[model samples]
Target: MPIFEYQCRECKKTFETLVFGNQEVTCPMCKGKNVKKLMSAFSHSSDGKFTSSAGPGCGSCSATSCGPS
Candidate 1:
């Protein structure tokens, strides 16, 4: 199960939820069903390899999205 970030429209509180196959999504605070999924940042790990989520020519990019060496 993947954890997703959500914002409650009713209470205006941000929370995390574990989403499982059509399961009901509700806010932890105020128990509000009116929630919106947020585009949260994520990271992935590669086994013993250098990875760059920023795609090619990451050295020239301003953002440092490339994983550590």
Candidate 2:
């Protein structure tokens, strides 16, 4: 089974679901059927470094400088 993330359009709630097969998906918060699957990031650590395609800062800072110069 794969874990899928979904965001509710009705209540604006985010949640995850473990799907085994083709089935109907609904928001757990408001039980609304209007939901959209979100493209989440997968992370892995190798050679003592963390890398991801989500870029740096994760939206914390908008500055161009990264770390102490």
Candidate 3:
């Protein structure tokens, strides 16, 4: 099973859950079955340096720029 992030269409809340093969997802807050899978961001480290695939906003926010100048 893989963990996936989802946004509830009914409650407009976000949550993470482990999904099995073809398993239905539901929102934990509202118990809504109508949910949409979100695109998850990832990061990696090389030579003790951390990098994010999100490019900005630390991969968790919608900010246009949040990196060091």
Best by lDDT: 3
Which 10 consecutive residues of model 3 have the lowest summed lDDT? 41-50
Model 2 over residues 14-50: C-alpha lDDT tens digits?
A: 8778767888788999999999988762353133233
Worst 10 residues of 2 by lDDT: 44-53
Give the count of colliding residue pairs in each prediction: 0, 0, 0
**Model 1 C-alpha lDDT per residue in residues 1-69, reported as the tens digit of each score:** 487778899989987678998988988879889999887524543342333344544544566555354
Comparing candidate 1 with candidate 2, which one achieves the higher TM-score?
Answer: 1
Clashes counted in candidate 3 amount to 0
What would the TM-scores of all predictions be?
0.56, 0.55, 0.56
- lDDT against the true structure, per candidate, is 0.70, 0.70, 0.72
Instruction: Report the C-alpha displacement of residue 27, candidate 1, in angstroms.
Output: 1.0
In model 1, pairs of residues that clash are none
C-alpha lDDT of candidate 1 relative to the true structure: 0.70
Cα error, candidate 1, residue 34 (Å): 0.2
Off by over 4 Å in 3: 42-69
Segments of candidate 1 deviating more than 4 angstroms: 43-69
